[model samples]
Target: MRLAETVTFGGSDLDRCAAERKDAATLARNLAEGGQVIVLWRGKPLVAGDPAKGACRLVRLGAEDPILRDAEEGAIFLGRIEGQAIFAMDISGWTPPEPVDEAQIGAFLDPTVQLHPGAPEGSAFRELRAIMTTLTARDAELAATARALGNWHLSHGFCSRCGVASAMTEGGWQRLCPDCGAHHFPRTDPVVIMLITRGERVLLGRSPGWPEGMFSLLAGFVEPGETIEAAVRREVFEETAVRVGRVDYLANQPWPFPASLMIGCRGEAISEEIAIDPAEIEAARWVTRSELLQVFAGEHPEIRPARRGAIAHFLLENWLADRLD
Candidate 1:
């Protein structure tokens, strides 16, 4: 796991200026003084330029741009990159001149060439998952942060303590409820995605709705008051009826399909028997290292490898190469 952070969406060590988030004067000055902003529309990021050249461009606008006027809430500070202030704003209500391509709007597990439409003149609203592997570390992290924060704001407009609508505050980092005096921050659901290994094989499962032949490391959300290790063990048992022991931390990835932090781990499976819970997964099986190599090589007929940018793929790839240290 030494190279774990080198995974996609993992290496950008962006300086998230947490203390300055609440400072109105600093944020205003930053915005007015050459601060660049990333635009999010309905959770998708604005990308322009060619992805083949490692320039899957993240559309950035200045504070004076007219589009900033249409932002639904205050810009959320996304920290600075080499002294340049970065922020994210929501423009979900803006009307596009063209219609989005319906055929290109579904879930794609593998990276495919895409042509997006229905965006502003120069940019296209691209699904981050599709192009995550092609983006630079900086761009990937920024897009993930923007999408996660924006999705949280969209879903948590009301206070859970009272049935009162909350107002965006703290530079869009927090919401304030007028009636209940309750303050809410953005939430990131923690999920444990473990690489379960029993001797020479690893266990993988396919969800009910996934594309044919696609399988990935077993994962589940961490329940309330549960530790990461406990969650990993419980999730493995619940989904495939496989008892896991000796769980060890591997790495993590920011999965922004509505804001999740995937904690990757390696586990020792004590019980090889699998009784897949149909409600949780469609099927489960064990694959040897040679079989996994075939899957990655596109030679396996029964299983497609995990999505490229996902932590599951990262873990499995490293494990197969005997580099999961």
Candidate 2:
């Protein structure tokens, strides 16, 4: 797609300096010299006041602060945001004690804060790419990593191998069980979202809990020992009773909403007979190009486009622009 990277958290040209991992001293020095600082208090992101008025944009720090001390671990280099030294913190496996003192925290969240309640109303959170560029791009990515990893720690505190509590190790990347010494790492489940097309119509479905009129591309988690191609075919056929052929990968996005890597693909539907698995999808249908255009423009009262910043939206927008070949 021509605008694939334009998706939220999609288009970042940050210099992820991987070589600096071995040199802790050098990395710390570099971070200190960097201009913008992205802070996370506890697990939730600390937005500077709020984003509605846009008062707390990234700014040059006059001096060092307590948050930057030893805050780096499982933290990777995100790109520069407006000449400020923007950095992300990976606080996985570490939960903050209760009684959050609002005054002592920096913004802590993946780039998806705008979608949640209490964040400013009537604001856009789906265009992560747009919001990312407006703030610290690299810092946003790093914060996302931290949030994802931290969530994993919260859920996977007990070792699956021996059913014992695990401890954070390897700089927040791996968890070690004190009883069995089992090492666990954060997970990124692969999900395939395909824009299945048969001539002029494309396949779309609405899950049981989705908002009214909201539909998205057919998707499913890739099972163990399954290729992306096989997963797409199985998912489409199982969900909508459509036989898929000629699957082609389009793009990928790191969705850290609890940790997922969305794999976008284009598939050809060999059969069009719609017989949805009533348990999985509430409704499934074929949408023509013109109908999709109306939905995108909010002219169609019966259908709502997929959430922005998602791979489904990326595929749909590209399909509209004639770039999804």
Clashes of 2: 16
* Per-model TM against the reference: 0.92, 0.73
Provide the global lDDT of candidate 2 against the true structure. Answer: 0.66
lDDT of 1 by residue, 1-325 (tens): 7797888888586898888888988998998899999988777788886666756878898877776676778888999888889999988777665665545555553232333343346567667877788788989999999999999999998999997999988877899999989999998899999999999999999998688889999999999999999999999999999999899999998888878999999999999999999999999999999999999999998999998889999999999888988
* TM-score: model 1 vs. ground truth: 0.92
Summarize candidate 2's per-residue lDDT along 101-161 as a digit string, tens digits. Answer: 3433322222443222322333222222323334454445555665566667667879999
**Leading candidate by lDDT:** 1
lDDT of each: 0.86, 0.66
In the order shown, the candidates' Cα RMSDs to the true structure are 2.6, 6.5
